[model samples]
Target: MKFKLIATFLLFATCVTAFSQEKQAQKSEKGLIKISIMYPFAEGKTFNMEYYETKHMPMVAGYLGSNLVKYTIEKGLAAGMPNQALPYMAIGTFYVKSLSDYQSAIAPNRDAIRADFANYTNVSPVILVSEVVK
Candidate 1:
């Protein structure tokens, strides 16, 4: 009975690990990662849109080169429902061709990129990486 339990546990662990690896493989094979950088608003705090759009993004261009295929910027005006405040002050989507390209482009300039954040907004940004299926 003890041996059977140990075998079952091992099998479960192996399956879990395999599933996680499969997902990782799929993400890499897709060859596209959407890097989302978003800043949420706080009362009395302002988003320095001028600096972000004009300065920060341009600086990023120096590091990415051709790896960054495209990008989009969004300004939060209002929420869908009345009396609801906008969740984010702004959002920037960076479309990376591949995971390796994203890593190579970002690794060297990570510090400089993060340091520039203070120039634009007080709120710390949230970053999310995802691959699009559709």
Candidate 2:
């Protein structure tokens, strides 16, 4: 019984150490680029949320890497706010080693992302760029 307790404690300690290392590694990364997307749906038209989830979002995730963080808001929930004109919106953060790294990674694929929007009708998207301040 005593041997089993020691073994369990060792296993728990090993797991905790591994988790701590991962969190530290994430914290050490620098140069984050934030991409905010705002869109509005026209009357009598519905936004294709599935296409964005399965297709466009995955593409953006692939380009932005595993550290990307995304946030989204829907129409009714966003109504009557100051920026209520935008019914749908998404914010994505990309973490990189440097600003040059961010620029180099996104430059070539920029046009492709812009052109892909034509496939979706009734949704007008506006993208804004920002840097992580803190």
Candidate 3:
């Protein structure tokens, strides 16, 4: 009876480990969908980079939860031409396993997320969704 119990325990552990590894492998194999939110730069336009990075992004990430692989924020420094104005003030990007995951996650929290934009910048955001290929 003790030997049988030990065997059962070992089997269960092995199955759990195998399942975990399979899940990890599948995730690594899949292509990630990238969502880019760009705020174009304009004369006299106001942007609160600190609030966007510190407060707004964190709130949105919470809503994204486990569906979000990761997120990043970029502040534009200068344009390609020397002494020229930047094309965008800032850009925010996030990655997810699939477009479906991002859609489902954003659908429910869309309102709250949009409402929070006022605390950050006045420029309207342009969105781009693409599959990451390397």
Q: Count clashes in each candidate, considering only residues at least 3 apart in sequence or on different chains.
A: 0, 0, 0
Task: Kindly list the per-residue Cα lDDT of model 2 for residues 1-24, writing each as its tens digit.
Answer: 999999999999999999998877
In angstroms, give how far residue 91 of model 2 lies from its true place.
5.7
Residue-level lDDT of model 1, residues 1-134, one tens digit each, is: 99999999999999999999998867664656788998987897678889988999878866777877677789999888999988899998887777687888889899999899889888888889998673
Instruction: Give me the runs in candidate 1 sitting further than 4 Å from their true place.
Output: 1-31
Which residue pairs collide, candidate 3? none
How many steric overlaps does candidate 1 have? 0
Which runs in model 2 stand beyond 4 Å of their true positions?
1-31, 44-46, 66-76, 81-86, 89-99
Error of 3 at 18 (Å): 30
Model 3 superposed RMSD (Cα): 10.2
TM-score of each candidate? 0.72, 0.52, 0.75
lDDT of each: 0.84, 0.60, 0.89
Q: Cα lDDT of model 3 overall?
A: 0.89
Q: Which candidate is the best by lDDT?
A: 3
When 1 and 2 are scored with TM-score, the better candidate is: 1
lDDT of 2 at 11: 100
